[model samples]
Target: MNNNLGLHETLELHELLLFKNTCLTKANTLSEVAQDQELKNILKADAKASQSEIQDIQKFLS
Candidate 1:
């Protein structure tokens, strides 16, 4: 990859990591007060997706 592209990828990966952390935090918070099962499920799915993205970005950065 070009140097500029690599830099962009790195920044993107960092952003992904931050986003994933935010999702995980929201999921945990919702779990504590969640009354709707469907909502909980959706939040869980989002957290899982974010986690998967983080893993993919980490692998790409390596």
Candidate 2:
């Protein structure tokens, strides 16, 4: 589970992951509240993209 990442890289990646998860959560919430179909679609797309990003990160991890 360890790589050559220094402390700064590790912290930055951790922060990045947390931010991505937040984006996913916010997107899902906004998607529910979005009245316009177009806006809702965009929010759903954003959520999907965030999930894909998490999968990519998992690839880097495993």
Measured on C-alpha atoms, candidate 1 has an lDDT of 0.76
Give the alpha carbon lDDT tens digit for every residue of 12-56 in model 2: 777888899999999999999989999999999999999999877
Full-model lDDT for every candidate = 0.76, 0.85
By summed lDDT, the worst window of 10 consecutive residues in model 2 runs over 53-62
Q: Top model by TM-score, which number?
A: 2
Please give, for residues 1-62, the per-residue lDDT of candidate 1 as tens digits: 23445776778778877877888788878866889999888887877887777777677666
TM-score for each of the candidates: 0.70, 0.85
What is the lDDT for 3 in model 1?
41
Clashes, model 1: 0
- What TM-score does model 2 achieve against the real structure? 0.85
Count of backbone clashes, every candidate in sequence: 0, 0
Mark the regions of model 2 whose C-alpha exceeds 4 Å error after superposition: none
